[model samples]
Target: MKIDKDRFNNFIHSYTKDELFYRSLYNAEREHPETFSQYVDTLDRNFIEQHQLYVPSLHDSWFPYISENEFFQTYSQNIYIAKHNRYSPEYLHKHEFYEFFYVYSGTCINTIQGKKQTCRAGDLCIIPPETKHSIAVFDDSVIINVMIKSSTFHGTFFELFTNNNALSHFFSHTLYEKTENNYLLFHTQSDTVIRSLIEDIYIEYYGHKKYSDSLLDSYLMTFWVILLRHHENHLESFLNTTHQNLALPDILNYFQANFMDITLSSAAEHFGFSVPHFSKLVKDHTGKTFVQIIRNIRLEKACRALKTTNLSISSICEIIGYLNPEHFNRIFKETFHMTPSEYRKKHTNL
Candidate 1:
């Protein structure tokens, strides 16, 4: 029997109301039990019965292998979203790319790499590549799978994740780690923004509106930041964090990009730390003081100018945030063990 389009759409729209679908399916199965037979195979168009759901079992095996190309339109985009009315039992299988899921409604019983967790609505399951996981979908539950290739995270996000936080181990899983269990569960049931953004992802994935991919990328990145920020807020213990490499490159990159006007006080304020705390953090992470970092960056620029450009020493001094040529010369020589003029002669063509 063909699914009632109206009833099917209702279940899709009102995900939390799985009982409505069950009641409808119950009525449909009363008339046609054979209509529900085709629901076993996920690839079948009739896999979703309007009024029926298969009883999920405790099967421990490999999860189904889903090809990236089947979901993604292009490798460069490398992202796709798939929704399911939770009923089938997932197997203990792993994938080649980063995969995460959002519980749209009800709960998802996820056994992740030998660990089990009950994922409720608004919970996010972050499973890294090659990690075994199985999801036992219960009746009246809906799940949305967001698949992203490893290439998608080869940017600033990777740096931020590995920027030496105490919880960094929970997020980034190495492809060739000695040991393999890695996954994260971001519990965000009370967060409205995360929930709304996730739902919008579902809409955009199916609707395919203009610039949906770009918009989704922005949303996805922001979603993780929010999740991490939420995680950071709950961090009450910092006693064992002394050994972490707090070398936040993105923060340093910002100073480099805006070196002209960045000050110790301003930089500290930008990162929401006190001046003393910021100074200590910078020193601990980079082994350089705020002034030293700024001075080193300015001197490097002066060196480049002396070699590549025909600017005079006095002009270069003024250009590199220095008012006195003698002062600039003294500092540059102290750092490089050679005067600016001598360095220029040695490296640049006269």
Candidate 2:
């Protein structure tokens, strides 16, 4: 369905918060005089049409239901039941929310950031914000999908991950193998505990009993602590490398702020180091060459622009610091496995 750009813009201007958009439609209906009915109808129809395409819909057999109560204000989390489906579209296809999923009944394959791994009945998957992921059900599945606001964890557990380059690298690239004591996949024993916790969450979610939201939030926090403990234990070994001593968080910040004007020599000079030393330090920390890191950052910006802006591919490339269109196209294709035009077509208005 084509978006009514005028209507969408008007809707945005009318609502202060995303949560109020629906309520605003109702208020607009009751308060506005002439054309009120038309405004409400258009808002309702446009919202449904726009979201229907953006959010993934499992086949009818999946039996998906969601409930969010006013009391549950910490984060937006929900339970999903997917009976059987080959795959669900990428969650980040339209939004950049951090997501977590706990499989309850059957096996599924999760593809995140281009890496694939099997997530079984007791396994849990955590997806960082802006990471692209899709799920393929191997059998009938019941899963709880929790979408946590970035702000909720931005300064807490999320900061822990971002503080260490190795941890961030592992999360960003979808590493599945156990490193040291940390295993992305739970041990059989831990899996059972996590499964029980997930079931408790589901019960609290659907029950909606008095104080249920508080109980559910507590369970989520506990589950996160467990996961973080495992991740931290496993990541300790990688943190011992020389690259860890170079202060990667600062470097990442610098790269992000100056990506539009970044050069290898300039980056090295920023850290008060020789070009070769700084390059090696970055390589050691991220396991990506300096050029690769810069390219990845540029590509990420391009992806965001493609999804959220009306700019043409050439314009996007220029905005993201690529002067040569052909060179940009080649790199974009190599990184995303699709041309800029295709990416824009798939994600625009989503």
Q: Best TM-score goes to which candidate?
A: 1
Please write out the lDDT profile of model 1 over residues 33-71, one tens digit for every residue.
Answer: 776544423222243344234433212332355554443
Candidate 1 CA-lDDT value: 0.62
Model 2, range 220-287, lDDT digits (tens) per residue? 66876665565444322211122233455567666766787799999988789999988876776566
Residue 145 of candidate 1: its Cα lDDT? Answer: 86
- Candidate 1 segments exceeding 4 Å error: 1-77, 159-163, 166-179, 233-350
Best by lDDT: 1
Write down the worst ten-residue block by lDDT for model 2.
Answer: 174-183
The TM-scores, one per candidate, come to 0.50, 0.41
RMSD of 2: 17.3
